[model samples]
Target: MTAILSVSDLTVAYGGVTAIDGVSLSVDDGEIVTVLGANGAGKTTLLLAIMGAVPASRGRIALRGTDVSRSRAHHRLAQGLVLVPEGRQVLVSLTVEENLLLGAHLRRDRQAVRNEIAAIYERFPNLGQRRHTAAATLSGGEQQMVAIGRAMVARPQVLMLDEPSLGLSPLFVSKVFDLIEEMNRSGLTIVLVEQNTGKALSVAHSATVLELGKVAIAGPSEALRNDHRLLEAYLGGAADIADEPSSMRANSQ
Candidate 1:
């Protein structure tokens, strides 16, 4: 398993307030790695730092074994590091298709861009149905799909999503998670920053829990799912109820 993206001893601060503290993690090629934590637990910071959106105070960020800790965000993007930020940052004035096209502006292959758009439409039929409409007119879930679609248009090797399920109905959330799984299955490495522990853990191959900007526990998803102490700390009794099989049931002994 080769690491597509690697973060080592990463740290970031804002006006002297430390956000991420010596954090390290890796996303292997074609793996879905979820980072779960409560609000202000430094989940967003980690993603931003990894994407080079925020400056790292100390650490190294590597993409496919190439050091990119100081690379510009756009440079990092070109290297296949893409971030679909937490909010639906679609352009209100642009048509749905236009906003999506903007996502592929860096690509020199015009035909490929068109083909990718067609593929995106196929993957997200709703967006295809409203390709000409203003992005502002789409519903929250639809807007989120557009955001994710935009990132996909980049054909990223490593896709980092922050709070992707925020403000969606359960059905839409399921759809989003399913799409994520589908993306990973299609050979994209993923770093998912999510608050929805149950669904995230269910879909992730592995996970890391962030506590106060540091790793609390990290291992295979099934192991973390069945660790009673880790579950109780992050999920309360909900973990117990969420576990459907003995394999997923938290082990107290």
Candidate 2:
């Protein structure tokens, strides 16, 4: 199958500093590809550039063979590329249901959008119970669920999530990771940007380790899991990878 998204020689700079440098990667249809790296390693920058929130200094970004290198952010969303940004930026003033509705603004099928909102509620019972509550009143994990629900409302073919597990308790992190896999199994391609390497590798179909804005390692997640040196460098150690027994399988997702 052809790649759903293709990025080549992508670079993003801030003033004179390069946040991302010559990054090249791709996410094939129906696969979860992860970009793993430490702080300031351009993981978020890569996502931003792909979503066209930040202009690339040099490179090509294509979706299903179409060149969208310089497409605007909304244009990318229309093309089935949606970004659930780092901070869960749900509309604080809006009710949970209203926030989900806003995400489907581009869709003309009103019934389908409504159905999707109901489906999201079913998937996240916590959201279902508090659908009428103001978003600001929800807890961190609840807000994260709303963010994911909002993105799903857009019905993106390829969802780029930045730091989905950030700031959540271990329990919430596990829950969120499972939801990500659930989303992927339900036919959404995902490009996960995560600081939590072990959890990311656990659910990713393939993984790429980025160092200082460039890809330091890119391979099947299993290979990376077994390679102590690479695993240690980007993911702490072999013990760390070993700790997540589920991540060592050929297909974690």
Candidate 3:
């Protein structure tokens, strides 16, 4: 099967420093591909580049056989690629329903937009119950739900989530992972950029470990779980990849 989304030899730099260096990865249709790394490892940069939120210094990005390397952010979204950024970046001043409405602003079909929002509400009944509430007043987990709901309204085929489980209570973290699994089971392809290593690997079909902007280790999730070097160097119990000695962070090539 062809990749629903793929990036090759992608490079991104911030003037004096490169955030990601010649990194490449792909997500097949309906598969969950997790990008794991510590802070400053360029995991988020990879997602931003793929979503067209940032420029790629060099590389090719393909979506379903079409090269989208030159596409703008909105155009990529139109191609069914959506990024729910980190930190649950909801418009805190807006009502829950209003925030969700913004996701469908690009769509012309009135009924379909309504139907999508309704489905989102059904999936997250808390949002349904408080649809009129201002986003600022919601709990962190609830706000995260709103963020995911907003993305769902866009009807993404390849939904890339940056830290869906970040900063939530234990209960919410579990719920967020469950939702990830549920969405994948419902036929949505996902590229998960997460710091919660163990949970991320548990639900992901495959995993890629990024260290200092390069892919350190990547393979099927099950196989990666048994990889002690990976677990010790990156997937240790921390919210981010564990800082290891120079030898530990060495390339797995």
Candidate 4:
């Protein structure tokens, strides 16, 4: 499969501290690739670097094989690269529909933009019901929906999500993952930065485990799911891998 987004030797630093250290990875066209790690492992930093929100101290980023290492955040967005940051970051003062409209602000086709808004409402009916409500008044799950919908309005070819499952109820987390799977099935490539290991691996085609700002293990989700030692070392403890599928048990042996 052709890579829709590629990062080679990407590194990000702040003052004397290097947050992302020579990391390299790729997201193939129409695949869901998850970046898994504990907090401060530089998962969020990698996503920000790819979106050009943070300057890379080294390496290259290519979108659909076109080099965009130095591109500005908006430029990357225009190139069909969009990031739904960790905090959901919806404009609290704006109504749900207004916030969604902002995602398509860079587009010149007003009518098409309007249609896209309607389509987003169709995909997320909860947002449609509260279209006129201020984003600040929405619940955490609702705000997350707004964030994802807002990014969708831009019609991105590659969408990068940072800690999308953060602070949501179990039901909402499942809903969010379901939406991601649905979107990927419709041919959208995704780079998912998440700490919710089980759900992340369940939906991901491949997994890359980041440790101390570098890749410690990278492979197909099925293989990684069965690697108990690697999971215990980087992902947490034995309980984390205890829920592995029965098929993974055979592979573990």
Top TM-score: which candidate number? 4
lDDT of 4 by residue, 1-253 (tens): 9999999999999999999999999889999999988767899899989999999999999999999998899999999999999879999999999999889888889898889888888877888999999999998888999999899989899999987877777677778989999999999999998766777888999999888899988999887776767788886663264434322322210
Mark the regions of model 4 whose C-alpha exceeds 4 Å error after superposition.
Answer: 238-253
Instruction: Put down candidate 1 lDDT per residue, 53-160, tens digits, no spaces.
Output: 889989999999999998999999998989999876899799899999988988999899899899989888999999999999998788999999999888899999
User: In model 1, which regions exceed 4 Å deviation?
Assistant: 235-253
lDDT of 3 by residue, 1-253 (tens): 6689889999999998988899989889999999987777898889999999999999999999899999999999999999999887999999999999988978899899889888888888989999999999999889988899889888899999998877677788878888999999999999998776778878999998888888888899888766756577664444334322212232321
Clashing pairs in 3: none
Point out the higher-scoring one by TM-score: 3 or 4. 4
What TM-score does candidate 2 get on C-alpha atoms? 0.92
When summed lDDT is taken over every stretch of 10 residues in candidate 2, the lowest stretch is: 244-253
Candidate-wise lDDT, in order: 0.85, 0.85, 0.85, 0.86
Best by the lDDT measure? 4
Better of 2 and 4 by TM-score: 4
| lDDT agreement of model 3 with the native | 0.85
